[model samples]
Structure formats: structure tokens, C-alpha cells
Target: MITIAKPGLLTSVQDLGRYGYQKFGVITSGVMDPVAHRVANLLVGNDEKEATLELTLLGPDMEFSEDTLISICGGNLSPTIDGKSVKLWRSVWVKAGSRLRFGGCKTGCRAYLAVAGGFEVPEVMNSKSTYIRAGIGGFNGKALQNEDELEIGTPSELSANISKILADQIEDKKFAEMQWTISSEFTVSSASKPDVRVMKGRQYDWFTTDSQMKLFTEPFEVTSQSDRMGYRLKGPELSLEEEQEMLSEAVSFGTIQVPSEGNPIVLLADRQTTGGYPKIGQIATVDLSIMAQLKPGDTVQFVEVSHKVAQQLYLDREKKIHQLKQGISLKIRK
Candidate 1:
């Protein structure tokens, strides 16, 4: 078990997301950065979709009840054990009675913390993701609050082996981190201004010629109003060449919808099942990690890419993830 002495910003337990019920009006609420969540689980020898603590811009101050093997990935929130920095993207062994604190965020907006086995939380709708708006899943159906004590699940054999190796070295130190780490190839870029690729939306041609041109050339600033539902951008006001009444259609993550207000809204993990707004574009899946890391006030320039290119990029990313899994399996036995 772990005790949250101080719950910073918004800490929540999340797996991949609740799926298959979107048609029934349930939104897919999950980790903003899927890659980070998977990586964190992999480091601790858990299944890819196991639950992890999704620490937002700020992190929590927690105390462990027992020594555990853990991993921290995604954003760099400067996590430390007993005032000593713990490296990201690798396995770490934390001793019981140790205190964990996070300093100011150096890059990225969120971090995923995974312990051996995984956080023990009840599943709702076959997923552990917390939809705060509906209060359906996760810890009591809400973000972690102060004084929350979460139970830890039983670890797998691989996790126990890894912990044994680190336990031998942590005879005195409060924590110990493994030497090797996952490559930065999958790390989300924390650049204030970044080029995000997207595929033309279904109604791309309906937009005025100038608006279409600006969509790729102009920059948009992410407003503070953004949340898990969507990122409302401020930049050029876009309008269709002619207004037309349209039926509501299904929307997925990264759907860039242009409403009457003209500004673009990038629907994210917590987006609604259907939308009536005209979609200007769909962000390339490969760059969703970069989008997830963008904080308020960050500016993003859209880069147009063909659907073919987008698919290839996604395939390449999955290949890397597969290789990482295989590498970890071999390394653990040594």
C-alpha cells in the first residue's frame, strides 16, 4: 500500500481506457499519453494495459508501506526518493518507509508511475480508467485526494526477480535504479512550439481556401481552458465556405472540430462519442504523444501529411514498442 500525504494537482489511476461503450454515450477517459502508460507498465513487468498513476503537471508526495519495484516514465517531473533523484524510463527499487516527492516539472505535462504488479483498483466497464466528469472508474471514481491509501497488487515472477537484484544494492540507500534505460526514440517532445502532423478531415474541402491554407501555415496557442476532453486552440478563426446543417457523427481522439466559433478544438481522450462540428483534420496518431505533452500557452503548428505517411509512422512506433518489450524480457533474466 501507498499513502498520499499530499495529492498534487490531479493524480488518478488509469489503464488504457473504457472502450466499446462509446456508442452508448460513454467517453473514453484514459491516460493522455498512451505510450508513456505502456512503457511504465512494461518496466515493472506488468501487462501493457495495467493501471498506473497518471500524475499531472504537479505530482504527489507519497509514502510506501513496503519496499517495491517501480518505474517512472513519460514527463520529467523530477521524482525523488528521500531527496535523491530517480532516473526515468527504467526500473527502480524503493524501500519501505521511504518518502517520494516530485520537484518542479522540467519537461512534459504528465508522468506515469507504475509499481510492480500494478495499482490495485476495481475495474469499471472492463477498464480502470477514471472518467472524472462521470465519476465512473478509478479510485472511488475521482482523482486521488490527500490521505488516500492505495493497495498494491501482487507482482509477477519477473517483477520479483528484478526487485531482488535491486534489493541487494539498496542495503542502505532508500532506492536503487537499474543501469539501462529505454531509448528516447519514443519520448514525447516537450518543445514549446512543435510541428504536429495531421490528416485532412472528412470535410476539409468545405473550409474556405484561406482557412485551409492557414491550417497548415498558421500557429495556434493552446488555451488554459483545455482539459482531458479537448484542447481548444486560439489562432486564426476558421469558417466553412458556406454553412450547412449536418447530422451528428462519431468522433475519435484527435478529431479537430471547427464549431461556429471558428477556432479549432482537438478532441482528446475524454471527448464525447459524437459531434456536430465540422472536423478540420485528425491529428496523426504518431504525434499524439507530442500533443499530450503540450501544456497551456504552448503554440503548435500543424503539418499536413498524407494518410499513407501517417499509417507508416504509426507502424514504426509500434515496432519500436515491440522491440522494447523483447529487450526488457531478455535483460531481466540476466
Candidate 2:
């Protein structure tokens, strides 16, 4: 059990997300950085889809009512347990009554905390994710706040074994003794601020040739009005050859919409189900996780790639995750 001492800017419980309801105009609300969120769960021996706390730019301060194992991943937020600093992308054991605190992030926007057995929240629409806009799912359909108590699910056999092993291995009484680091190999590396790969959209030809060329070559700054919904970009205004009303249609995550103002708005995880604006491009799924971490005023550039290549990249990523899970299971058996 855990109690929130301070709920930062925005913090909520989330799992993989609610799917198969897009036909009903519901957008999937899940962990923005699926990779990081999964890794945190892996460290704590939780299923990848297990519910965990998703902390935004700022994070929460919490106190544990019981001894528990937790793993933190995504973002470079300085976290501390019982007043001692701990590392991100690592698992640590907190004794009963220990306080966990997080400072503002230095690089990324969201951070994930995967407790052993995962956070147990009521599922709505078959999802434990909190969709704030809809006022449904997770902790009474809202963000966590001070004095809120959270319950954790029953621990899996793997988690039980791992916790016992961890307790025996660490001999020191200090906080460092409880720390366990996750491999950095799984972390994404961007060439610049954020290297986002995109595919030209159906309406790509509507823009003048020069405008299309500039989009690929120029750097765009993220406007302060960015959130989980979409990112507004500031760059050279695009000119359309023939401006006409667009029909509202199903839009997927990462769709870059060009409104009448000519500025692009990149739809994100919690974006609307349909949009009528012209889509200039669509960022690859793998790259969308990287884009989710960018803060306001951050610079980003788009590189064009084929849809086939994007699909292949996504499959490869899933394969890697599957292999990692298998490897961890094998280690537990030994």
C-alpha cells in the first residue's frame, strides 16, 4: 500500500491502454512511452500490461505503508527514497514507512513507476488507464492527489522470487543497497534533440514542393501549448495549392494535421479519434515514444521513411520485448 504525499503537476495510473473501441470514437489512453513503461514493469516482475503510476513533467511524493519493490524508468527525474537519492531505470526496495520523492525532470516529460504486483486500480472500458478528459478509469477517474491511498495487486510468483533474492543480495542498510540498475541497451538514442521518422500522408501532394522540402530540412520548435493530446509546431507556414474542407476520418496516433493556419499539430496518445484537417505526415510508432518526452521549446526534425520500414521497425521492437521477457523468466527459474 502507498499514500500520496504530494501529487505533482499531473500523475495518474495507466496500463497498456483501452483498445478495440476506436470505432466508438474512443481514443486509446496508455503510457506515452510504452518501451520505458514496459521496462519498469519488467524490472519489478510485473506483466507489461500491469497498471503503474505515470508521472508527468513533475512527479509525486509518496509514502509506503508496507515494504515494497518498485522500479522507475523514463525521464531523468531525480528520485529519492527515504531522503536518499536513487537511480532511474532501476529497481529499489523501500521499507515500510519510507517516503519516495521526485524532483522535476531534466530531459523528458513523463516517468513511470512500476511497483511489484503493479498498482491495483478499477478498470473502466476494460482498461486501468486514466482518461482525464473523458472522466473515466483509474482512481475514480482522476489524477492522484495528496493523501490518496493506492492498493497493489497480488504479486506473481516471479515477483515473489525476485524480491526474496534481492533482499538476500543487498547487505547494506543504506539506500544504495536496495538499488538495482536496468540495462541502458534498451534506451533509445536520437541523433539530435529528437529524431522522429515519418511517412508522407495522403495529402502530402497538396503542399507546394518548396513547403514539403522545408519541412524535412528545417527544425521545428514545440509550442508551450503541447500536451498528451497533440504537439503544436512552429516553423515555416505551409501553403496549400487548393484549400478545401476535409472530411472527418479515422486518424491514428502520430498523424500530423495541418490546419488552416498552416502550422502542424502532431496528434499523440490521447488524441481525438477523428480529425478533418489535412495530414502532412505520420510519425512512426517507435518514434512517437521519443516525441512524447519532448518539452516545450524543444527542437525536433522529421526524417522520411517508407511505411513498410516503419512496420518492420515496430515488429522488431515487439520481438525484442518478447525476448527480454523470456530471458527474465529463464533467470527466475534458475
Candidate 3:
């Protein structure tokens, strides 16, 4: 069990997100950084889709009522246990009644916390994620608050065995008392404020040749209006070859929509189900995670990629995740 002593900024519950309900107008509300969220779970031996807390620019302060294992990943928020600093992207065991806190982040915008057996939040519409716009899912369908009590679920056999191994490995370290570092193969270094790759959309021909060239060559800064729904980009205005009204259609995550104003808006995880603005391009799935971490005033560029290449990259990332899980299992047995 855990108690939220200070729910920093906007901490909320998130999982892989709700799917299959987009037809009914429900948006997929999940962790902004899916890779980091999954890594946190993997370190604690939780299922890949298990629910966990997603901490934003600031993080929460909490106290564990019982001894349990937890893994922190994503961003570079310096975290500490009982006033002693600990490392990220690793699993650490906290004794009963110990306090855990996180300082401000230095790199990315969000962090993930995967507790043993996950966070034990109730699932809504087949997901435990918090969709604040609709007031559905997560803890009472909203962000956690100070003094809120959270229940822990039953741990898997894998988690139980891993905890024992971790406990023995760090018995000598003062700060990391019973912590074990779990290395992640997916490096975010290349992702830091990266240029997102995009594929031309159905309305690609609407833009003038010069406008298209500028889009690929120029850098755009994220506007303050950007949020989980979409990122508004500010750069050279783009003019269309022909003025036309676009009919509403399905818009997926990373869809870069260009409105009449000429500025581009990149749809994100909590975007609307449909949009009428013309889409100029779509960011690849893998890179969308990097896009989600961008803050206002951050600069980014767009690169073009073939659909076949994008598909291959997606498959390769999945393969890497599978390999990492297998490696962890082998290490546990050794």
C-alpha cells in the first residue's frame, strides 16, 4: 500500500491506453512515453500493460505502508528514498513506512513509476488510464491528491523472485539499500528534442511545392497552446495550392493537421476521434513517444520516411522489447 503525501504537479494513473472504443468517440488516453512506462513495469516484473503512475514535469511525494518493490524510469528527475538519492531506470525496495520523493526533472517532461503488482487501479472501458478531459478512468477519474490511499495488487511469481534477488544484491549500499539497477537498451539520448519523422498524408498535394520544402527544412517551436490533445507548431506559414474545406475523418495519434491559419497541430494520444482540418503528415509511432516529451518553446524539424520503413522500425522496436524481457528472465535464473 502507498499513500500520496504530496501529489506533485499532475500525477495520474496510466497504462497502454483504451483501444477499440475510438469508433464510439473515446480517445486513447495513455502514458505520454509508452516506452518508458513499459520499461518501468519490466524492471519490476509487472505485465507490460499494467497500470502505473505517470509523473509530469514535477513528481509526487509518497509513503509506503508496507515493504514493496518499485521501478522508476523516464526523464532525469532525481529521485530519493528517505532523503537519500536513488537512480532511475532501476528497481528499488522500500521498507514499510519509508518516504519517497522526486525532485524536478532535468531532461524529459514526464516520468513513470511501476510498483510491484502495478498500481491496482480499477479499469474503466478496459483501461486504467486517466482521461481527464472526459473525467473517466484512474483514481476516481482524476489525478491523485495529497493523503490519498492507494492499494497494491498481488504480485506475480516473477516479481516475487526478482524482489528477493534485488534485496540480497544491495544489502550493503546505504542509499540504494536493496536496489538493483536494470539497464534499458532503448536509449533516449537520440530522442532528446529530436526531429520527428513524418509521412505525407492524404492532403499532401494541397500544399505548394515551396511550402512543402520549407516544412522539411525549417524548424518549428512548440507553442504554449500545446497540450495532450495536440501540439501547435510555430514556423513559416504554409499556403495551400487550392482553397478547399476538408471533411471530418479519422485522425490518429501524431497526425499533423494544417488549419487555414497555416500553423501545424500535431495530434497526440488524447486527440479527438475525428478532425476536419487537412493533415499534411503523420509522425511515426516510435517517434511519437519522443514528441510527447517536448515542452513549449522546444524546437523540432520534420523528416520524411516511407511507410515500409516506418513499419519495419516499429517491428524492430517490438523485437528489441521482447529480447530485453527474455534477457531479464535469464538473469533472474542465474
Q: Write the per-residue lDDT of candidate 3 for residues 1-334, one digit (tens) a residue.
A: 8999999988999999899999999999888888889888888889989998988878999998987888888876778887888778877777778888999777777788998898777899999999998899999889999998989999887788878876776555432333345554564443535778888887988999988888888888899998778999999998789999889999988999899999999998789999999888899887887788787888888889877888899999899888878877777677
Q: Give the Å error, residue 203, model 3.
A: 1.2
TM-score of 2: 0.95
Off by over 4 Å in 1: none
User: Which candidate achieves the best lDDT against the true structure?
Assistant: 1
Estimate candidate 2's alpha-carbon lDDT, on a 0 to 1 scale.
0.83
Error of 3 at 111 (Å): 0.5
Measured by TM-score, the strongest candidate is 1
Instruction: Report the lDDT tens digits of candidate 1 across residue range 1-334.
Output: 8999999998999988999898899998988999999999999999899999999889999999999889999999999998889899999999899999998888888899999989888999999999998888999999999999999999998889888888888778899999888888877686778999999998899999999999999999999989888999999999999998868999888999999889999999889999999998999988887888888888999999998999999999899999999899899897
Error of 2 at 245 (Å): 2.0
Off by over 4 Å in 2: 170-180, 188-192
Which whole-number lDDT from 0 to 100 does residue 105 have in model 2? 73
lDDT pick, better of 1 and 2: 1
**lDDT tens digits by residue: candidate 2, 1-334:** 9999999988999888899898998889888888889988997889889988989988999998887888888876778886778777765766777888998677678889999998888888899999998888888889998899999888888888777776776565433233435456566443356778999987888998987987788888899989888999999897788887789998888999899998999998788999999988999987887888887888898899899999999999889888888877777678
lDDT of 1 at 225: 87
Off by over 4 Å in 3: 170-185, 190-193
lDDT at 45 for candidate 3? 83
Candidate 2 local lDDT, residue 135: 87
